[model samples]
Target: MSLPDMRFRAEQHLRRQLDFQHVRTHGRRHDCGAFMLWYARQAAPIAPVAAVPAASTDAVSPDGATPAETAPRSRSHQKKSASGPIPARVGVVASKSAVGNAVQRARAKRRLREAFRQHQLRVPAGYDLLLVARSSLNRLEYREIERRFADACLKIFPAAKA
Candidate 1:
């Protein structure tokens, strides 16, 4: 049975080679023993607010000289404003050289993804995470893997919300 909290949304998935490369290039790294974690916070997306045209220039008077042109500016337009924080995204990597044969690599990645999915909320918003599996990953118990992931979360995001 799939739990809502454990449902890995598409938005929360890190796809595309560029994104993977970006996280590896600029993100901070943490060694979880069985895996290496790399994470970087992304900037939130901002929606631009349309500006209202300054009260139409005092309509042309008979003289044609607009009063607005003559009057000292009394007010300025308010600054444009509006505020996706893209949901936290995670990617798993289990290379042949790192995690062994195909079956082992797949298992390692699956475990890592499942672990991240279950406690993803513990991670703050707008972060890109990469979990690279090691050969040791397959040898570890699921509970131990989960615990290490939790500890890694704490060390990486010390102020993470409960």
Candidate 2:
């Protein structure tokens, strides 16, 4: 299949400067802690990194309302999907078991891409994103995958003042 042209359309499009391969390489076989250190040491640190905000989770609200105190929260965390500045790139790692067949794997990937496309607003510009799909994706709902993807992005790129 032809890969999408993830090129930067405008100067602000992160697709121009993002290094999807680099993010994946740094994250290979490593956890978030290790990844964070690797980022600090690397010459080309992932640009425009933002830590996932606590508010993004089901925690205290900006107004200090507990989950019980407020109306049911929207599934914002599960909604985050893509990461990058210009042509924001998304990485995928599917388990060999769940999506055992080539067709299933492709389907899973398509769903992931759709998730990314739907949540472009949450992702900031000019950043590289790596997505590691858990084996359970075959069983998990699409929204769950989306949420986890966003959380992972936030973990990798915390929202500090730019």
Tell me, by TM-score, which candidate is best: 1
Top lDDT: which candidate number? Answer: 1
Enumerate clash totals for all models, in the order shown. 0, 18
Question: Over 4 Å off in model 2, which ranges?
Answer: 1-20, 27-85, 95-98, 158-162
- Per-residue CA lDDT of model 1 for 1-162, tens digit only, reads 954466887767777687788898889999999999999975333445444445566566567767555554422111122332456789999999988998998899989999998778779877889999998999999999999998999889888765
TM-score of 2: 0.44
lDDT of 1 at 71: 50
What TM-score does candidate 1 reach? 0.71
Clashing residue pairs, candidate 1? none
Tens digit of per-residue lDDT, candidate 2, span 1-162: 975443432332223223444554553332432111112112243334343445545688679866556654443212233553243445454455645677767767666666556554445554444444444555767777667655555565576221
lDDT of candidates 1 onward, in order? 0.79, 0.46
How far off is residue 130 in model 2, in Å? 2.6
Model 2, total clashes: 18
Task: State the RMSD for candidate 2.
Answer: 19.6
